[model samples]
Target: MKLGLVIDLDTCVGCHACAVACKQWNTSGTTGPLTDYDPYGENPAGVWFNRIRSYEVDDYPNNKTVNTPMSCMHCDDAACVTVCPTGASYKREEDGIVLVDQSKCMGCNLCAWACPYGARELDEDSGVMKKCTLCVDRIYDEALPVEERQPACVMTCPTSARFFGDFDDPNSEVSTLVRERSGYAMMPEVGYNPVNKYLPPRQRPKAPTIEKKEAATGQTLIGKWMKRQKDAFNDFGKGAR
Candidate 1:
């Protein structure tokens, strides 16, 4: 079904809400208790599934900030899966979600090195590799409400920038948004054919400029107020003298 995410870059505000949510939910999920080393210390580090990166586009006056939240792309030609010697990393045939079996992992670090997107991380505590699982445990659970069966990141995004659905379905929201917004895959030249898509920032509408003829004269409210302030200051200065 090619289940994946379609992120809207235009609406994302670099809040890191998705990253926080992913960490919170997945810590106690199927891949529970993600490792954290020196969280309160100077060199705080942890195994995080989602990461938010912001880049400044263009230069100076015309510059814009682009916030990109990245995780496992679940590529069609997933190199992470191919590189795993013990078959620890594998992609699901039914949904195209990439997952790491911690039990089978041998702390080889091959999959982490092979991943071009830096989506995989080694859990030193468990001596195994960890990555985004698309919240498979939550999505397929019958106990949860139907509408609440999305990934933690998708559910917690405050701006509604994240969407999750089957990319293979033409009628799905992900597919429709991809078609309408001209969404694109990251680093397509790498040939991984990532399922996750990102919608580019839309061009902002320019503010209408006031022509010279439409400029406010001295009789305008603001001009008159300024004139009154000047006169008051001059009178105060004369009285002080």
Candidate 2:
């Protein structure tokens, strides 16, 4: 019954909708004090359960942008749990979620240092290490309808790119999707054994075009020079804009 996420990189639009939805739901409900500091001032810092980062994987002539949604990995051998001296941080065997018992925490900040993925953070108010609980409060509440019980971020994702399910079940949607689409774990070298898996970027077929030949042959010297200048200007504008 180990619960987890299955995020699809293929359909993600690089929009921050998922992150914003997490913040919005976690603030006024069962989630902790997701505070924002100096919001209007010079620097703005806040606790975020989910973060979306856009990565440019420019494979030269065939470039692509991948938008990754990152959060607590809820690992099988979670380092934060091992580092907690007071048994505050523990992984739930039933659902495979890692949580910190705020009442027992001493705000030692040791747990945060142990996490290589930057998953842990010190909660100033609770004096404890805080991270994504995968919206545990909503998931377990019997008051809500069974199907409706899911993480706020997953529920609000416009593209339906986020999936919630039991990874242990071989036939589950998440697991089936993983197998069919070639899913991969993030930072496998770290050996955290994360429950969630990222579906690999689908390989698109190269269309037969005259441009490929033009690039390979380096023909039309003047045209090539013009295209280069135009490319440079476009790149500069993209950076600036």
Candidate 3:
């Protein structure tokens, strides 16, 4: 089953909630206690499974903001898995989730370099690579509610922009969204064939416009005020003469 995410670019508000939620859950997850260096210092940096970026579409009045949250694409031709020197990073055949076996990992930065999406991060505390596992542990756990058994990012997205499902199943939600919304893979030209898809922003509805005055008989408050000012100026001119 090719399981993955369908992210809607139109609805994503770029709140970074998905990133924070992913960090929170994964910190204590199977491969974590994800490290932070100088967290409180001037140069704070840490390992994160997700990152959000905002970009402006145009200039000034016509500008539109696009918020993109990126993580492991879990590509069908995963470069990270192929470049793993110790065979630590691998993609699961069952669900297509890319993961690193921390035990086998040698803290080599090769996988990170191979990935074009910059999905992988080196956990300094564990001295191994870390990335999104699609919350594999949570998804398979029978204890959690069926509805809640999604990735932390999907669950916490306020805009409901992130959707997780089996991409192999044509009837699945992700597949349906992809087909209906014209979802697309990032950097398909690179040939990684990323499993995750991104739905482009929907066309915005045009703003309602006020109708032009037909005869200009009705005077507005502002127009009346302007007329009064004009009348006063005329009277002042007459008195001056």
Q: Which stretches of candidate 1 lie over 4 Å from their true place?
A: 206-241
* Residue 215 CA displacement from its true place in model 3, Å: 28
RMSD of each: 10.7, 4.0, 11.1
Better of 2 and 3 by TM-score: 2
Each prediction's total of clashing residue pairs, residues at least 3 apart in sequence or on different chains, is 0, 0, 0
Mind giving the per-residue lDDT tens digits that candidate 1 earns over 1-241?
8999999999999999999999999999998677798888998898999999997776433557899999999999999999899998999998899999889999999998988898998988889999999999999999999999999999999999999999889999999999999999999999999999999999986546544332234477777676677557445434343
Residue pairs in candidate 1 whose N, alpha carbon or C atoms collide under 3 angstroms = none
What is the TM-score of each predicted model, taking all chains together?
Answer: 0.85, 0.85, 0.84
- Tens digit of lDDT per residue, candidate 2, span 121-163? 6767556667888888888889999987999888999998999
Give candidate 1's total backbone clashes.
Answer: 0
TM-score of 3: 0.84
| Model 2 alpha-carbon miss at residue 224, Å | 8.3
Each prediction's whole-model lDDT (CA)? 0.90, 0.82, 0.89
Question: What is the overall TM-score of model 1 with all chains considered together?
Answer: 0.85
